[model samples]
Target: MGKVTTGASMSIDGYIAGPEESGFDLLFQWYGNGDVELPTGHPDMTFKTTKASAEYWRSLIENTGALVVGRHLYDFTKAWGGRHPMDVTTVVLTHNPPADRPLADENFVFVTDGIEAAVAKAKEIAGDKNVGLNGGQIARQALDAGLVDEIGVDLVPVLLGAGTPFFPSLGVKPVQLEGPISLIEGKAVTHLTYRVKK
Candidate 1:
């Protein structure tokens, strides 16, 4: 069986996005500041990262077969211009799906149920690969339900004084994790992974 995981690019002070959706320039500098070229499904989207980060990204792409994202994130990027850059099937946990894409297509799946249902749908699509949960809310819900298997954090140097935090409040506080099972240093980012200790 595949694992369920979530990850984010966070600042030193633990913000995934800055206030008013700002600070992206500082948060994502590593994405374009490196020599290694990593291409995405979007023609215009490509990542230039250090060799280590490139390897990490490649591994993520290989292991992640599907994703579960919240509606807020879906709307934020305008559904990533009709498709997610990862080129994988995405399940959106939304109260109401968008009008244009009313049905499930190659690009997206809409789940009106709760987070568990959304994760289940993504798992069904993922098969032997991992199901990546996107956004802080989704992760917190899954963590509260004890569904997540691992957590990955790409730690950057800068701190956003106020903004969306990477790890949101979990009802289950003091959750235990085992091992920084994997760690790598990239250009201005340190990638860390921890297994959720149930």
Candidate 2:
């Protein structure tokens, strides 16, 4: 089996999205200057980044074998137009598994059962590689279930006063993390990686 991990770009206040679930447009401002283009086909899409930063993002995408995401995120990105940015096997956790699966690419799978089932399916698909949790809520679910192996945060410097928090109350015992594997200080963000204590 492979390790389950998660990574998110958050604000100083720990919000991944702004008020009214406004999207991470501001939080991910680092990628807006032609360094990275999300959703693949934006009108102003471009890819230009420093070697280190490119490698950082690439490592996450290349290393991940499968991804688990929440339904809200799935819909937010329009299911990434049926093709996720990472191009890996994606399991979407939702009660409503679209009426027609064929609308999406073969790489996407909707798991209606629950978060555990989604993670299980992702792990099954991932094999020896890592299964990445791609949304805050799903990440919390995996962490609460003791299935997460690592939690990575690209801590941005901004402060969104009121927004969707990245780590909501799990209502469980405190979870410990150790060793920030790397702390890459960028002009707009600081990447922090920690291994989840078992």
In order, what is each prediction's RMSD in angstroms? Answer: 0.9, 2.7
The models' CA-based lDDT, in order, is: 0.90, 0.78
Worst ten in a row by lDDT for model 1:
97-106
The regions of model 1 sitting more than 4 angstroms off are none
TM-score of each: 0.97, 0.89
Stretches off by above 4 angstroms in model 2 are 34-46, 103-105
Compose the digit string of candidate 1's lDDT tens values, residues 85-157: 8889999999988888865988999999899999999999999999998758999999999999999988999
Collision pairs in model 1: none
Model 2, span 1-198: residue lDDT tens: 678999888999888888888747777766654444333333334455444556677777667888999889988878776567677878889988778674235578888888898899888888888999964788878888888898889888888888877767775668888989778765577788899898
* lDDT of model number 1: 0.90
Error of 2 at 89 (Å): 1.6
